[model samples]
Target: RQFGEGGAELFHSHRAGGIVLPTGTVRVEKLSASFTELPGFEDGAWWVQDAAASLPARLFGDIKGLRVADLCAAPGGKTAQLILGGANVTAVDISKNRLARLSQNLERLGLSAEIVQADLLKYEPEQLFDAVLLDAPCSSTGTVRRHPDVPWTKTAADIEKLADLQRRLLARAVTLVKPGGRIVFSNCSLDPLEGEALYRAFLAGTADIVDDPLRPGEIAGIDPFLTPQGTLRTTPADLELGSPERSGLDGFFAARFRRAG
Candidate 1:
């Protein structure tokens, strides 16, 4: 209502809960400040987040009473979503500065979580969680449109390096969640070797974890993104679909796996 009238031509990511985006919107590409300065933001109704970026947190369905971990969580947009979705979240990140932003975001949203500052590989919890979200560090090629610096900053060697790091983080994330628990692993990279291929290898080597395919209508407008294995491979351009407005999303891949109990 307000968003539409504001000349932002936004789309509702879902009727239930999500940040409404101006149709064809990209992250941080400023819309009119009217929406931002409105009472909704000032009143802590919602925080800024990319629509595609929000999907990984939603992969763990109905985690109301479940304990979850946002491993490598900094600038905690997904952490807030988990908290709102009824999961008790332990947000972990390596950087103090990034954690500080996450803390401030949570506070503004009137949400709360247990915050841990430590490296994902080195950090160990006394008990594992029921679910975990790992939005790993990547080459950022998928985010080139929103983050123009990504193309200039990342290299092929960097992609390989990040892929290796992603594997390490996924391995650690698996250990942090209980058997039968799910790990939603996501990376903002378009490379198959980095995302799809790497996860396929992880599945081959690890017998206990199995791929959990996403179903149609589970997440609105998700059909085109599904790969044969049921993982999600999202591109920035998908949302536009010939829309007259400028639209796109960061390249991102997400997969869900549940450990064998």
Candidate 2:
């Protein structure tokens, strides 16, 4: 049942025997049907952005005329969000193939950005930005509900490797932001090692805590789930247990940081 060429067939064959429901239908079909009905997919007003993933664009407060960089910007969902929020965005990603997809999205939305295909770990822009967002790549555990096949594909060692890469990307992003500018570090991951732990390690030596505005009543009974300083964590259960409309959100974690002046 696997459709793609890259190890997908093996993954699908293995998964086919692992889970079974009363209806005897494939879970993938059910998931696809649910996704197609989501608001973002129909009118194309917005893409499927995790509720928590939207927080980073707001962290900068005012970006109307500011220079912003979205590193690791492939598949450009965040890039589009930033532009809609009024930042003059420069979207960077290492893959030309992925950037092609990003370009298509921008064209579809009638939005534009300086899309650069370069390895952010080594690429440098001619000018610095007022703010930057490093939505670093990581072991995507937070997406488990939407991507049930992830846990079967990834391993603990993969997380460790990604953590190291994230650290490097954060350091580079910090270097690119002006003093007093902001950077929001985020990952679609529930692993504290990749989310909170990565932020803590970065803040320990550079940057400082900054307030993150939460939607009123967003954290009703989950104070412990809130970071000590009020970062946000969107969980699968939070979505699944809510009304059908709310159940469409993907799991995510996000934190905002400010460069020390």
Candidate 3:
């Protein structure tokens, strides 16, 4: 029954019956329908972002006037959050199409950011930032609920390729932060290879990296699977049927790292 390259079509149609968040009371059905039919789905009243994904921006502490760079900021979910938090944000991504979407989202939210379309590996900013958010692309295993197609479309080889890219992106993002600034590296994948594994590797290669902790009670009703070593993860199963509060969130993994003085 698997269809499409890597059986993506088959995987997309198969919904896991069990709810990952057994105690969650959020209504799963209404959330899904709202996302698709919401008036601003395309116009950007709200962007598809996980509750965990919002943690990295908070780790920055305070950014009222600080210069911040959001590397790989296509479709600008994190970028929008940063701007809303009061940082002067600069968003960069390699894909022109996605950048257009990011721009639109910023516009809809009544926020503004300097949008650059360029590969972070080769692009250079005019100055270092107070903080940087590198939400790198990965195997996306942590996002199976929203993107079940990922398991079918991606392979071990694909994960390896993404890991390589993540390393490069991390290296470049490090260079963009000031000596005392912070960098948050995150992905929507559960593979330790993408989440904790890559983070450990980055710390091993660089001496300035330090773990940044999440604020108290930032994640109150989220699924337990989403929390690990201060990182937050969300899955589709976390949404509760019949309840309308915790539904409609995509799975995500996030970690915050600071550049040491």
Candidate 4:
């Protein structure tokens, strides 16, 4: 249902945040507003997640009943998305504590998934999945707008170390998918070294894998952020839809690939 006149006025006057995504995701652009205090949250009508962070899982068109592995999937945001899309998800993370939080979230959302605690490097499944999502660990430079201290907390060397780790985790994710299966690799770092450069290096070496670029109009408001090679790259400076205080998305990069049959 469309908003009534009064509702529309309120929504516009408050300058809410991002456009409503197809998935019904409503981004909270007002940084000072306590989103949790709003209605619908208590009923699990929504969950907290940066709009940019919510894009990678959506690269999978229709995952109904598809088996998906979510590597390094703690806090369960993407995992929850996949489950909502009707995918059978195995959410894996190394931190037991984080997995516990994920469990709580899933329960609150009335969603379910097979949760596992394991280091991605050593994780093994009895069956290969139709797809895998690797939201690898990174320097998290993309979120500096929300956490200004991020730039001072890490170094180039730290980024290099994290990039290497992401490369390995991505490689592992590829192995877990069956032939012709898809993989969406992503990280929350603005540096190309941890994103574009790293994926390119891996693609150059992996002959069995091929890029599966996003189709035009696949994601609403996504055209401005797409790379020429069809990857999604968003920075805090992108997505200028609101006031200067709430105009950009978090820095994130993501690419999709398919294994040769």
**Which candidate has the top score in TM-score?**
4
> Rank by TM-score, descending?
4, 1, 3, 2
Model 3 score (lDDT): 0.69
- Candidate with top lDDT is 4
Model 3, poorest ten-residue lDDT window? 1-10
Q: Write the per-residue lDDT of candidate 1 for residues 81-148, one digit (tens) a residue.
A: 78877889999999999999999888877789999999999999989899999999988788877888
How many residue-pair clashes does candidate 2 contain? 0
Candidate 2: TM-score?
0.75
lDDT per residue (tens digit) for residues 105-128 in model 3: 777666799999998989888899
Q: Give stretches of model 3 more than 4 Å off.
A: 1-45, 215-228, 239-248
**lDDT by residue for model 4 (1-261), tens:** 012113223333344543454323454555445765654444555677777888898898899999999888989889988987889999999999999999998886678999999988998899999999999999999999889999899998999999989988888888999999999999899899999999899899988899899878887666777888999998988765545544577899999999878
Which is the better candidate, 2 or 4, if ranked by lDDT?
4
Q: What is the C-alpha local distance difference test score of each model?
A: 0.78, 0.68, 0.69, 0.82
- Clash count list over all predictions: 4, 0, 6, 0
Between which residue pairs do clashes occur in model 3? 26-243, 27-243, 27-244, 142-189, 142-190, 226-233
lDDT (Cα) of model 2: 0.68
Off by over 4 Å in 1: 1-30, 34-36
**Residue by residue across 56-169, what tens digits does model 2's lDDT show?**
555566689889999999888788878877889999999999999999877755679999989997888999889999889988887887799987787888888998898888
